[model samples]
Target chain A: MKKQYWTEYESKVADDHYYYERSCIRQSFFTGSEEVFINIVRDLLGKDIADDMNLHTCSGIGYYSGVVPLDTTMTVVARLFALMTEAGYKNFVPSCITSFGLVNEVVDMWHHFPEKLEQIRGYLKEANGKEFDVPENIAHPCDIIYKYRKELKEKMKYSLTNVHTGKPLKVVEHIGCHYAKIFPRQVKGGAEFPQVLVGMIQEWGGEVVDYPERRHCCGFGFSQYMVLANRGYSAANSKKKLESMQPFKPDFILANCPGCTMFMDRWQYTIAETEGITYGENGMGIPVLTYEELAAILLGYNPWDVGLQTHQVQVEPLLDKMGIKYDPKDKYVGKSGAFLGEPEKPTHLKVKAYE
Target chain B: MAELLDMISADIRYIDGLKACMNCGVCTAICPAAEFYNYDPRDVCNTLMSKDEVAIAELLKTDKIWHCGQCLSCKTRCPRGNVPGLLISLLREVSIRMGYFTESEEGRRQYAIKKTLGEHIVDSGYCVHVMHVKPHLHPEQGPVWEWYFKNSEEVADRQGGNYNKEGSGALRKISEESLKDLRKIFEVTGGKDFFEQIDRQSKKKASELKKNITDNVDDNEYFYHVYREKNETQE
Candidate 1:
């Protein structure tokens, strides 16, 4: 019996030994996303990778937010859910940086917060009737894919191959704060400005342009922006990011997570309006694209087909610059609650945890 | 003055100060707190200014207020110097009063960062600014601390300023002392003792965790090793 419908990403995880963790918050926000990444990784890396996967909610993220507490053992047990994905496997990947850091944080601090860790261990023991060994190795999705960048580049069937135009295409990198700050060490390919995404982009033939405030948070801290005028602050951060990259003349600003993509892309126009910052057609007012979107484009997929035009700012110039033909109808309709079909699942999807 | 003070005294001292911000968003761009967390400093300013109690109240329910790293990076850079970071401090104060984020685990963790580093500054007449080599160069952050706690004068000299000169650099001590007072407002306001206990636990727990991490840290420590080795090789 063939599986009814899993994202192409599942194929890669199944074949590639994809790493991941399950996040409670993400599971709550969009349950389909983790499932999408999971199924995709399983399909790609072969079932063995999923067998070794453990996606779970990070232990302490919500506690600091004062939302979830130390006693909120559900988040920790959620790790067991991911472990069950691979039957209590070795290190799995976490897509969400926060989940990655917080899970590791709980494990690392368990020796110190013995009671907190033990409480979590106890819950997992009773509830799942299973034990977890916080594996010695773990990594964020970016850190993992970054390790195989050369292989990804070699296996490329797409023509983002021309994005650099035989000359290095200018691009700026935004490393999520949780990725850098949570567990600065688990990040292999080295830490301290690990350049996981940027290195991958460079390997794919794009220049990883360094902008000031490169490692600044994407302003998603607990979705404060959604709750208030964090829009202004997010917009402001976007300006700082865009302004910093102005000198470098990057063709596009690339974001990693969905939150950063939303703020950087949506808030740029608003930030520009409020701050009185000017933008030329192909200038400082650039659009933000995620690596998934970037990868889709790098593979020479149709811009609208992959939702490029869904961007708030006009992404035409970059396409025009790249000489990539774009579908006119691909433009995102007004944000008046119009369904643009489901957001395209990124091909070569990386499995993750809130892990 | 009555109206302004009325706004200020209305349980949240930042109400008046926050109103001064036009929501220009300049503060958010420069805030180091926003750099690490998903918070927008300007949003706190905007929320305080909105006078829309429900929105403000709903927002206060989150722990984002505690995410403020309080580097004063936003304060220095605000076009009006409005200090959204400080405004968030006021929010935390109000949240404490309202019992929103009182004694949060993160706050407890922060309390430790402050008690260990902060208490020492209050007692020692110095801040971490003077002690420790540039954080990037110091791996353990202890040796440089041990040395610079005594020899900070050389760093002061290098910066072309004598902090001990009562008329010039010493003036900073006044603000530092006052800062201790301002923070006391945060400490003693509502759940001060609760904050203290969490701070204690966090400091104890954090140090223990750091020891374990450091003990297990592989041959490659942090960027400190890379920088030092690279500098030596370059030289």
Candidate 2:
């Protein structure tokens, strides 16, 4: 079974000269993730990642939530490809896992139904007065990071080992379900155990914690989170994963997808607030970080500069564990050195160094 | 009534997602939504396979189809390569098109998404823009998020975000030309029509329920009804 799925799951990642597509959720919520990703890929690793200011959202959220039709999604994606084509790049790299999956789904549709692709082309020409060729390569940023894991490790100022215990941090790798489950072949490792994140963690000197519900969705179900009443379903699914990973006592939850990273971090606060349950030691919720933010910390970037302060579950605990130093006073300090007020302290979730 | 199976069959997602279901229940076993809710991906697939239009129509109107999180986890585990999640997507599209979605509590919430995410796409070229993330609406974002949004510009600037600026970077203002092109794409691809249908149907439902809905979809009265109203019994 493994061999069959593995054989079916081959994909080629472009080494350089890529068109970087931004993620709506990551930009809106985790504002620093995309910056950290671009810095790591472009500045640190010395890769050419060309971005277009004209690129728009893939509408994956709206499409999956059933408000935007699939045809609309296809046309929107076609416009994105058109922009990439205009920029003279064929390697498409979306910052969001949802966009990656949706783009792959649209391209797969085009492959199976040429008429639909033609319709999209007509729509593109009529609407935007442009044309597009499907990208030659579609790789997620994590895939690129995985491709350069060894080089990144070579340049790392810190490792995933605990400063206190002198042990490898037990990291829970949460693969966004859409990242691989939608099309196993598109992912680095097959759907069951996606190695994109695990590979990064292992190479960066962290032990991967194998939990039972590791394969479960972080429950960002586009509709589930969008609708206020349906949020219970979203919170419940995250609670399930946290509960499963609680026994292992992971140092942090590492996710590649923006939605997964956000939900896994925020839902910990929700669970702590409602149920008074904390997943980490000393009544603290387990911190969640995107692979980029994790990589940024290892590459010696300041914690707050990577937008770690925006995270619901405070990343200070994880930073402390990994021996990454950050000024506690700088958590709310802005670029001009002004103190931008702090959040109202949570009643249940522990913050400020386990006290 | 439109043939439910035909509507589903027309979608490429359905053609690819549904191959055959021997009722193995692997999809159900691995389904997180099933574990949490009354949803069963196996049953959803079986219903479609049965080709019973009435049963299928009934499934469309119920809250079951709306329960899927769109994670596509079922696609990986099915021995016959069935993708129950994609089946849910097609079912949802059919339900909305046929006006069956408004019949259920969960389905009515699509109105909120239509007003927010759907409209955000046509208007701002983003489904969830930073400016639209009201702290009051998203309390789960927690207090820190409240702080960030309170000082969003400064915080964004510190993090190297353009923050609604004219140039490329995180949260840069999507260009008007790009937005015009996006709106055109939506207009040409039936997205505009889809949003209008959602508004029309939701307003009708609001009137049927005597909620005094106004012309503006973003008004608090009707918006809150669809966005926040919770039905414990059905859901």
Query: Highest lDDT, which number?
Result: 2
Off by over 4 Å in 2: A1-11, B2-5, B215-218
For model 1, the superposed segments whose C-alpha errors exceed 4 Å read A1-16, A22-61, A73-86, A125-131, A158-165, A188-191, A229-231, A273-284, A323-326, A330-355, B1-31, B34-235
What TM-score would you report for chain A in candidate 2?
A: 0.97
Leading candidate by DockQ: 2
Query: Which pairs of residues clash in candidate 2, taking residues 3 or more apart in a chain or in different chains?
Result: none
Question: Per-candidate DockQ versus the true complex?
Answer: 0.02, 0.83
lDDT of the candidates, in the order given: 0.46, 0.87
lDDT per residue for candidate 1 within B143-199, as digits (tens), equals 213333343343223222233433222112224432343233223322235345444
Deviation in Å, model 2, residue B117 alpha carbon? 1.1
Error of 2 at B148 (Å): 0.9
